[model samples]
Structures are given as structure tokens and as C-alpha cells.
Target chain A: MSWMHTIFALILLPAIATGMFRILRGPTAADRMMTAQLFGTCGVAILLLLSTGMGNPVLLDIALVFALLAALATITFVRRTWHGSNKRNHGNPL
Target chain B: MIYSILTLFDIILILTMLWLAWCLLNTEDIFKAVVLFISFGLLMALAWVRMRAPDVALAEAALGAGLTGPLFLSALRRMNRTRKGERRLDSDENREKEHKANQEQG
Candidate 1:
């Protein structure tokens, strides 16, 4: 409920927007993945800012879950890329 | 009155976030871009803390910046190798063509 929290929330908006642009415009798939991760990070920050502004504790749990899922998805992508390259190399002899 | 300091903190956080956004958008190399993205995550965590959300800060640091960044980088490295291999193959084929031409002439 503090003015400080409100101001912080407002500031985060444009930053989040910029990150979203990167997500949309990234040249490589990996760059897009990184941008998506940025989105997740910013989303968590937004939720936290809202939780503080609203004096609610429940949003903390949501943020925690989001973070876990984001990390898991990233790791999965990494594993898939590794396996994909390995398969390509095996078949092509290059 | 008391909120004035909070407002200042908010402005500072916002500026930092914007700087991060610029880096994420303009970085030339994918690897460096990924690193900047991770740093952006950490800065967002700090922003969350300044906003009084310690739980979110902890989660962002652990998952977003810590675990996710490296995962992406590793994946990028793997993908880079495949591209490199294709280029190598192309060069090899070119070399083979040159060798055949030389043998024919000799």
C-alpha cells in the first residue's frame, strides 16, 4: 500500500516490455529461449510487487512455483539440444 | 513523507531494469546476450526485494538467474557445434572438388 511499492511496480512495466521485445525479435532459438527466461523473471518480479502492494502472502507461493517451472523448462531444452546435436553428428559423420 | 525514500528506490530499480533491457536487446553475441539476460533476472530479484517481496527474490535468484541461464548457454553451445560441422562439411566438399580437378589435369 506504500507509494514506494506503487512506483516500483510502474517502473517494472517498461523494463518488462523491453524484455518482451527481445523475446519476440531474437534471431536465434537460443536467444528466444533466453528472452523467455527473462520474461519469467520479470513476471515473478511483477507478482512480488503486486503481493507487497496488496499485502497478500499467497502470491509468494505462486512466484515460487513459477520459478521452479521456468528452471525445469530451461533444463529440458538444454538436454534436448544436446541430444539433438549428438544424433545429427552420429548420422552425418561430421 | 515517509514514502519519498521508497519512491527514490523505485526509480533506481526502474532505471537498472531499463539498462538490462537494453543490453538484452542490443547485445551482438548470443552467449553474451544470455549472460545479460541472467543478470537482468538477478536485478529483477533485487527489485522484488526492494519492493518487500523476499520470497520472490529468493525464487528468482535460484531458478531464473541461477539455473535457467546456464541451461540456455549449454544448449546454445550444442547448437553452435552443429552449425560449425555443416560449415566444415562444406569446406571439405570444396577441397575434394579441387583435388579431383588437379588429378585430372596431371
Candidate 2:
């Protein structure tokens, strides 16, 4: 059963790695941000799998924190960074 | 079987992290670099978990991925605004100098 969890975790790593390419070729800031969102989701999943695989329930708490922080980071980026830029710089397209 | 599988996972995780770090440093766009950095922090936390350091993983995810990313983004925005302001101020100063020279000539 632990092996199963480990295998699944291994499979997800490639998925996140492929998302890195999208970050690299992004034509806009939003695209790169979305890739980061994907990374957050995958990170949570991998953490959960590891918790069960290693028989250490403590990793579960780390996964929960990861999930929360990921959301916070995205909200900060959207509100403080992206939204403010458009409104504050009316004449410029920054 | 378990040993081999774990070894494979470790190898893949290390390679992915290395690639991400390389991209984060070399990317031309600061926004992309910030995003890559957040992702890298997340991966680094996972690496700590693999090393049986769950406490460190928690800290990395919270501080590195969560806090540092927003800080960088805000800093980037502020820097851009200030640079534009400075450029405009420079132009205004040049205009003032030209006006003063014209008055002196008159």
C-alpha cells in the first residue's frame, strides 16, 4: 500500500515538470501565474502521498499548510500586484 | 521493489528541482522568475519531507513559497513604479533647465 502511494507520487513529478515549460514560454504574466497555481496543487498531492507512504502522519500537517499558503500567494499576486498595476498605471500598459 | 521505486522517485525529484532552479535563474522575465521560484520552494519542501524533515518542509512551504513570493511580487511592482517616476522627473528637470536658458537669452 505504501508502495502504491509512492508510485503515484512518482508519476505526478513529471506532470509538474512539464508545467515548468509553460512558465518558461509564457507570453504574459498571467500564464506564468497559472503555472505556479498548478505547481501548488501538485505539491499538495505529492505531500499527501508521502505522508501515507512513509507512515508519518506529521506530513499531513505540512500538506495542509502548503494548500493554505498556495492560495494566499495567488491572492496576493492577483490583488496587490496584477490588479494594482492596471489601475495605478492608467496611461501605461505595465 | 520498494527500495528501487523510492530510489527512482528520489532521482526524478532531484532532477526536476535542478531544472527548475536553472530556469528560475536564467529566465529574462522577472514575473516568470518569481513564479518559478515559488514552485522551486514547493519542491524543496518536498525534498525535505523525503529526507524525513517534516518540520523543515512546513517552514519552507510557508516562508519560502508563501511569504517570499508575495514579497518579491510587491517589490517588483514598487520598483517599476519608482523607475517610471524617476524618468519622468528627469524629463521635467530638463524642461525646466531649457526654459531658464530661454529666459536668460531673452
Candidate 3:
């Protein structure tokens, strides 16, 4: 049973790896931000699997923290970084 | 069998983290580098969990991925603004110099 949890966690590793390629070559800042979002979701899943496999309930809290913060990063990117750059494109103040 | 499987997982996780750090540090674009940094922090948190350090993992996820990412993004914006401001000042100085030269020539 423990092995199952670990195995499941191992399976998610490839998805994260593939996502890194997007981060490496993503043309737009938004693409890179979206990839980071993917990382947050996958990290949470991996943490949950490891928590169960190792029988450490504390990891669930870490997973919760990850979930809460992922959105925060994306919101900051859109509001502060992305919004300013797009002002010229619209030719109006946002 | 399970022990060996866990070891394999650990090895892969370590390798991935190293690769992420490498990419984040060397990327040409500041925005890409910052985004890569956020993901690297997320992986680092996972590594902390694997190492049986839940407290560290919680801190890493919250500060490393969450707070630091936005902090860097805002800093990048500030940097770009200052750069634009400097360029504008330079152009204004150049225009003043040109006007003085034209008056003297006329």
C-alpha cells in the first residue's frame, strides 16, 4: 500500500519534467507564469502522495500552503507585471 | 523492492531540482528567470517533504514560491520603469542640446 502511494508520486514526476520544457522556451511571460501554476498544482499532488506514503500528516499542511500560494503568485504577475506592459498595446490607461 | 523504488524516486527528484536551478539562473529573460525560480521553489518544497522536513517544506512553499515570486516580479517592473525613465531623460537632454545648436547656427 505504501509502495502504491510512492509509485503514484513517481508517476507525476514526468509531468512536472515536461512542464519545465514549457518554462524553458515559453515565448510570452504569461506562458511561463502558467507553467509555474502547473508546477504548483503538481507539487501539491506529489506532496500529498509522499505524505501518505511516509505516514507524515504534516505534509498535508504543506500541500495546503502550496495551494494557497499558487494563486497568489499568478495574481501578482497579472496585476503588477503583466498589466503595466499591456498598457501601450491598448493605447489607454488601465 | 520498495526501498529501491524510493531511492530511484529520490535520485530523479534531486536531478530535476538541479536542472531547474540551472535553467532559472541562466535564462536570458528576467521574467522567464523569475517564473522558473517560482517552480524551482515548489520542487524544493517537495524535496523537503521527501527529506522528512515538513516544517521547512511549509516555509519553502509559502515564502519561496509565494512571496518571493511576486516580490521579484514587482522588482522587475520597477527596474524597467527606471530604465525607461533614464532613456527619456537622455532624449530630453539631447533635444535641448540640438535646440541650442540650431539657434547658434541660425
Candidate 4:
């Protein structure tokens, strides 16, 4: 069982690295946002795998919290993007 | 033997993850990239399941793949339309001049 955790970490490490590259090097703001979301999700998965490998239930709450936070961050980004474009369309009445 | 079987599944899961990651990186269209990223999230969930982390798998499927992916794609679509509209608003004479300039420069 412990080996399984190690295996997953090894498997996911490269994927996470590639995602980080996208987050850093993405050409557009939207690309960076998507990459950041991917990284957060992968982090949660890693935490869960580690928690289970160690037979500890406490980490489940951490995973949940991380998921909620990631969702909130994505929502904020979406709202900001929408508002920015709306301003552009309306000719910046402000 | 059971342990070996489990390891084999893990290997397969890892391979799938790599493939998804490749797709996410190489897709040209932003919309397609978002879709591939979501698929990558789903594959990650399966990888977690194979590793015996059901809780993580659920979170990955729900929050990672499900909510975030669609949110990003819709946002991208809106951004694309706004950009297109801005370009369309440009006067035709200006557009033609710019096109001619580009041809001359190239």
C-alpha cells in the first residue's frame, strides 16, 4: 500500500511540472488561470494519496478545504474576466 | 501476485496520466486545451482510485475536472468573442491598410 503512494507521486510529478511550465509560460491570462487550476487539483490528489497511504483520516479535511479554495479562486477569476470585458464593451462608463 | 497486479494497474494509470498531460500541452486551440486539461483531471482521479484514495478521487472528479474545466472554457469563449467584436469594430479602411502594410512588411 505504501508503495502505491510512492508510485503515484512519481507518476504525477512530471505532469505537475509540465503544468507549472504552462502556468509560468502561458501566452494568455486564461491559459495561466487554467494551468493554475490544474496544479491545485493535482496537489489535492497528491495530498489524498499521501493521507491514505499513511492510514490517516485527518488529511481528508485538508483535501476538502483545498478543493473548496480552488473552486472559489476559479470563480473569482471568471468574475473578473467577465467584468473586464463588460467594461470594454460599454466604453468604460466609469 | 496480488501485489504485482496492483502494481500493474498503477503503471497503466501512470501511462494514462502522461498521455493526458501530453495532450493538454500540445493542443493548439485554447478551448481544446481546456478540454484536455479536464480530461487530465479525470484521469488523475482514476489514478487516485487505483492508489486507494477514494476521497481524493471524488474531489478531483468534482472540483478539478467538473467545475473548473467548464468555468475556464466558458470564460475563454467570452474573452474570444470580446476580442473578435473589438476587431470587427475597426473601420474597414483601417483594416485594409493594416493588411496591406503587413503584406509589404512580409
Candidate of highest lDDT: 2
lDDT per residue (tens digit) for residues A1-94 in model 2: 3889988888998999898888898787888898899999998998889788777899999989988888887888889778877766546756
TM-score of 3: 0.85
Measured with C-alpha atoms, the lDDT of residue B103 in candidate 4 is: 100
Better of 1 and 4 by DockQ: 1
CAPRI tier of model 4: incorrect
Candidate 1 residue pairs that clash: none
DockQ of each: 0.06, 0.74, 0.70, 0.05
Q: Which residue pairs clash within candidate 2?
A: none
lDDT of 2: 0.85
**Candidate 2 C-alpha lDDT tens digits along B1-106:** 8678888988998999999999889977788888888899988998999888988888998899999999999888777867775333236776798689889999
**Can you write out model 4's per-residue Cα lDDT over B1-106, one digit (the tens) per residue?**
4466456656755775777687668866665566567656756765665566777777766677657875776677566865774553256976898799889999
RMSD of each: 11.3, 6.1, 6.4, 12.8
Q: Of models 1 and 2, which has the larger lDDT? A: 2
Error (Å) of candidate 4 at residue B104 is 49
Model 3 chain A: ten consecutive residues of lowest lDDT: A85-94
lDDT of 4 at A19: 64
Fraction of the true interface contacts (Cα pairs closer than 8 Å across chains) found in each model? 0.00, 0.84, 0.79, 0.00
Q: Which tens-of-lDDT digit does each residue in A5-90 have in candidate 3?
A: 99999999889988899888887888988988988898889888988888888888998888888899899989888886656443
- Chain A TM-score, cand. 1: 0.79
